[model samples]
Target: MIEKEGFAALVLRLRAEGVTDLDLLTAFEQTPRTQFVPPQFASDAYSSRTIPIDCGSFMEGADLAAKILSKLQVRPGHRVLEIGTGSGFTAAVIGRIAERVLSLERYRTLVTAAQIRMDALGLRNIIIRQMDGSSGLHGEGTFDRILVTAAFSAMPRFYADQLVSGGSMVAPLILEDERCMMVRLTKTGSRFEREDLFPVPYLPLASHIAQHL
Candidate 1:
């Protein structure tokens, strides 16, 4: 568990970083980041840097996580999909607000670790699967909200197609300059509208191009 002072410090830092949603901030403060991190790095859990997790992946910064979750605009009865379930921390946070959270992780090690963490926290609303996040899960559609924690060169069309009308997606899109930009995409009729939110850096999702020779 994180101390109150440490949690307060995290909240202040996130607020300064432009995470203004009180509900998101409260969720971040309530979740114990330390528990999701490796035991040796527990002390640094509240720090503002990304800490390495299993399978060469790392947990996103607390501020970035808060910002992404804030933009998700989840509600009590919303169905959510989360790509790249790192330590299951983000999924757990979404589970708290959304009616159901379906998260995917490609790495078996990370998937196992995340499941363990979620079970320990007794977060039953999240269903984790070991599958490719870039391609997205099949047979699930009409999600009220979708989130991709990993960076991508372009928005995955599959994800946009799965969103329910009026649903929104928050992801880090890698531009030509190799810089990452946080973008929010909201479904409007048969099309989706995009809004650039902020600049961010995150590990890129393992794409098909990388998987094949």
Candidate 2:
């Protein structure tokens, strides 16, 4: 288990690494990562290393997560759409920063567990659902920001279309050379402006909904 002092130290370390957003930092600091991981991996909660979650998914490391949040620049009034809920730790953190968060997970087991964790933390603004996130909630209205936790071989047009003009999406994109890197796409009048953020190794975003966990 990471002691209180250890967690604080971790936050401080993130701060040193350029995660300077106050609200983003606070959201991460308050949302206990230990609660999102399995009991066997509790000790690795605050480390800068990926950990496994249910349905063969992996939760982003705390440091990388903080960086993603920083790049997101979520405002208090922004509505965020998270493509993969995974353990729901990122959604939980975003729930504290954004006005609302609609997190999509393909597996029912993950949806149930993530919802339970959200409810336990009193995060009423976050809604976790079991759906193929690759499609980007069709009937649902637009979003101010979209965070895709999985890497995409190419930028999905549907996701860019779902964002309101001037809104942005931060996702792991597969480069031409087959290297995966984080990229931010800002929608502007039916067009998107892309910016590269950082390199990352992530599983491809699945398009098919799982029938079984």
lDDT of 2 at 8: 84
Model 1 alpha-carbon miss at residue 84, Å: 0.4
Q: Candidate 2: lDDT of 151?
A: 89
For 100-120, candidate 2 gives per-residue lDDT tens digits of 999999999999999999989
Look at candidate 2 and tell me the lDDT of residue 95: 94
Q: Looking at model 2, report the run of 10 residues with the lowest lDDT sum.
A: 1-10
Cα-based RMSD of candidate 2 = 1.2
| TM-score to true structure, per model | 0.91, 0.96
Candidate 1 lDDT over residue span 111-138, tens digit each: 7888888888888989998777787777
Q: Pick the candidate with the highest TM-score.
A: 2
Off by over 4 Å in 1: 208-213
Clashes of 1: 0
TM accuracy, model 2: 0.96
lDDT of 2: 0.89
**Clashes found in each candidate (C-alpha, N, C closer than 3 A):** 0, 0
